[model samples]
Target chain A: MIIGEQKPFEEIWEMVKGHKQLTVFGCNTCVAVCHQGGNKEAEIMASLLRMRATQEGLEIDIKNGGIERQCEHPFFESAKALLDQSEAVLSLACGIGVQFVAEKYMNTPVYPALNTTFLGDVKQDGFFTEKCQACGDCVLGVTGGVCPVSRCCKRLFNGPCGGSSNGKCEISKDIDCAWQLVVDRLQALGKMDDYEKLVPIKDWSKDRAGGPRSFKLEDF
Target chain B: MAIDAEKIEQPKSPEKVRDVPADWKANIIAFACHYCAFAAADLAGVMRLSYPSNVKVVRLPCTGKLDQIYLLRAFERGVDGVFAAG
Candidate 1:
């Protein structure tokens, strides 16, 4: 899922300070799964804002609201009434959700409350580790299900670098050498021969080098 | 991206856990590797050497197997401090 973390409260307050009416919008999807942006988080943020405004003698009308998913137009329709009543929206969603709201509501200023971190898997409750870079290529079959491109600090394809010591990366003791893991998995799976074959250079055009990407369905 | 006013409140301070009593002992988790730290701990016990009663020792195959998540979870679970011994 897309993982993100809430920006500091001070930064969020600065964005909505001038607006008389503001809505703390939450997206109950990917960001919610990461525990960063959700209904409960939106309410907490609204409460914090209210406390701050009251302490500073600022007259601000802040409302807490959430939608199932902010990236879809139909889902945003549920928030139309709340959005119409607000001068600005403080979106507690990932970057994509914030941009989608801004595009749909051109008149109202939309601000992001979270920094979109990465595409990752929740290893455990409140713990996430990155697993992909969206390089538009798949090599997991030969690599024994480990992603050297993303897991390897140096993105080395051929083999483990000389810097790997005691099966750990030179960058840090906490980091496992990605190539070492790949070779171990391959050996255990009886696919050691795959490691002997040198991997070819990746094509840059297939990745971000081509700029923003899109997909279309012929059936649609 | 820009601050409109200089009067914004500073970020809230981190929530403080309840303070321990004056006589409360510290809770420390020691991740001891089976090869060395665990053996040493065992030897210390055999020799009848006294150590802090509050220290909890966990034996692992190797200290390298210890993940950062384990340390974080320990703190979340109210462990005051932790150290990995290899």
Candidate 2:
């Protein structure tokens, strides 16, 4: 998912300090999954802003709204009424969503309420596990489900590094050796013999060396 | 009137329960995380802690699980606020 986190309140306040009217917009897609910005989250943030403004004796108008997907123009347009009333917008979406809002609402200054994090998946409950580094390589098939690109603190491509102690990575005891898990899984599946097949050096040229990558496919 | 009714004494007057009328009812909808926040609420209940009874809780696995459509949809249905306790 598009992993992200809420920006500190102090920073957000600084952005909208001079604005009399504000719109707090949340995203429903990636940011919502991680609980940074959703409808309820937006409301909580709005209430906090309300309380803070009240305490500060600041007459700031706060209107809360969120869209289905902030990256898409259609979803953000749904919040037009609330957005139109605001002098500035505080977006709780991912960087993409925030940018989209800024681009669409040219008149209103858009500020971000969350820091954009990389692609990640939920670990258990509160912990989010970072998976892909977005290195533009698809190597999970050869790694036995363990992603060395992300799981390895050092991002090792080959076998276990010298820093591996017991079954854990030396960088952090909480992190298990990704390669060890990969080897174990492969061994159990009688594919350990494939380890001898070394992979060729990755060509970064195809990755993002040309800047942002885009792909298009004609409709079937 | 019967003779038994004459023996009854007058009751004392009742006192007012409020100096000011109770405030308007607060409609609270909280989307709580199943991990920490939900456990905390359960603990509060078990400890007999008192809180405003106006809260309506909707438990979710994580704050991450919430979707934008769901949040907006609730307000479209007239929910006053959405809270993330976790």
Candidate 3:
């Protein structure tokens, strides 16, 4: 999932300040799973903004609404009335959603309420850890389902670097050495031979370094 | 007269207890790491040490795992204060 964290309320408040009509727009997909930019969050943000505006005696028309997904145009169609009425939109979706809304509604100013963090999985409730970097290359087949490109601090492909000590990275005691984990998994799977095999230097063009990446289907 | 007698004989349900009091002294949410803060809380219990009862602890693997949403949600739900203990 694409994990994100909401920007501080004060920072968000500053963005929409002085706007006569504002909508707290939320996305119910990726950001919602992280508990950051869902319908519930939109309601909370609306309440907070309303309470603050009342205390400061600010005259603002604030509305709260959410869509199934914000990156697609069809999902946004449902919110056309609210968007038309809004002078500005404070988007609680990820960076892409905010940009999509901004592009779709060129006249209205759109502001991001979340700092897009990382591609990660929910370890448990309220806990998420980054697991992928979308490097456009798959290496998990030989690495025993762990991507060294994302987990390793140095992105080592061959083996553990000199910085690994006692299954932990030298950089911090809290971080387990990614190479150590790879080796351990390989050993458990009786695939230590895979560790001995040398992996060639990765092609940089296959990664984000190449440019903006996309996949198009000719069948479509 | 019959309705009044029936009402008097009917069993009454117990009043529900509020998790948060209307006149609350404090409403605190404490995010405690299982390794340290949770252990400390356990020790306090074993020693019978007294502390504010209003502080509710939520356990996590590490304090680094704490998310800003959890803190915000606490305040949104009427919590007065929040503390993170590693």
Model 3 residue runs over 4 Å out of place are B1-86
Tell how far residue A4 is off in model 3, in angstroms.
Answer: 0.2
Please, what are the lDDT tens digits per residue for candidate 3 over residues A113-138? 99998999999999998899998888
Candidate 2: where is the Cα deviation over 4 Å?
B1-86
Pitting candidate 1 against candidate 2, the one with the higher lDDT is: 1
Model 1: colliding residue pairs: none
Q: What are the per-residue Cα lDDT tens digits for candidate 1 across A1-220?
A: 8999888788898899998998999999899999889876887788778767765778999888999888888897877889888799999989999999999888999999999989899999999988898888878989999998889999989999899999999999988999999999999999999999988998867789999888799999
lDDT of each: 0.87, 0.79, 0.87
Specify the poorest-scoring 10-residue window by lDDT in model 1 chain A: A47-56
What are the chain A TM-scores for all the models, listed individually?
0.96, 0.92, 0.96
Interface RMSD of structure candidate 1 (Å): 10.0
lDDT of 2 at B17: 54
In candidate 3, the residue pairs with backbone N, CA or C atoms under 3 Å apart (3 or more residues apart, or in different chains) clash, namely none
TM-score of each: 0.72, 0.70, 0.72
Alpha carbon lDDT at B84, candidate 1: 95
